[model samples]
Target: DVKVTQSSRYLVKRTGEKVFLECVQDMDHENMFWYRQDPGLGLRLIYFSYDVKMKEKGDIPEGYSVSREKKERFSLILESASTNQTSMYLCASSFGGRPGYTFGSGTRLTVV
Candidate 1:
């Protein structure tokens, strides 16, 4: 089974602070994604990478960025976090053109 691990389960930061979230996958999947889940907005894609050194902007790419230096690892960066950005962040990995994805446990971020 594919396992996605998030570095942090919970995070609390003040407004205007920079934050970094890391994710690692056991499977060598080609596609990795970062999503921010809100109550009504559902899961909104922030960023995704198909291969190492290649990335694409998703539905909600503003104020966020991603990196995929290795096939099994991906990182999400919040450039100067804000209060409205506080939400549950999810990381997912899957083979390209697959049906479903293996999701991480999620990291709940709170900006005060």
Candidate 2:
């Protein structure tokens, strides 16, 4: 079975502190993505990497960035965590051009 793992299940951050959320997948999938899920807002992509050392900004990449140095790991970094950044962050992985995506449980981040 494919599994995506997030570093945190819950997080609380100060208004302007930097934050990092890590995700690792054991499936050796070629595509890894980061998304933020919010109530009524649906899932919005933050970043995605299709290959090692390559990254692309997703729909909502303003305050966040991602790293993918290896095929099995992806990291999401918040330049400066803010109240507006508080949301459930999810990591997902999929095989090349596959229709369905498998997601991690999610990290509920609260920036106060």
Weakest lDDT window of 10 consecutive positions for candidate 1: 64-73
What's the count of clashing pairs in each model shown?
0, 0
Q: Of the candidates shown, which would achieve the greatest TM-score relative to the real structure?
A: 2
lDDT of each: 0.93, 0.93
TM-score of every model? Answer: 0.96, 0.96
Per-residue alpha-carbon lDDT of candidate 1 for residues 1-112, written as tens digits (9 for 90 to 100): 7699999999999989989999999988899999999998899999998899899999999998888889998999988999989999999999988968999999999999
Cα deviation of 22, candidate 2, in Å: 0.3
Tens digits of lDDT, candidate 2, 36-107:
999999999999999999999999899998888889999999999989999999999999989689899999
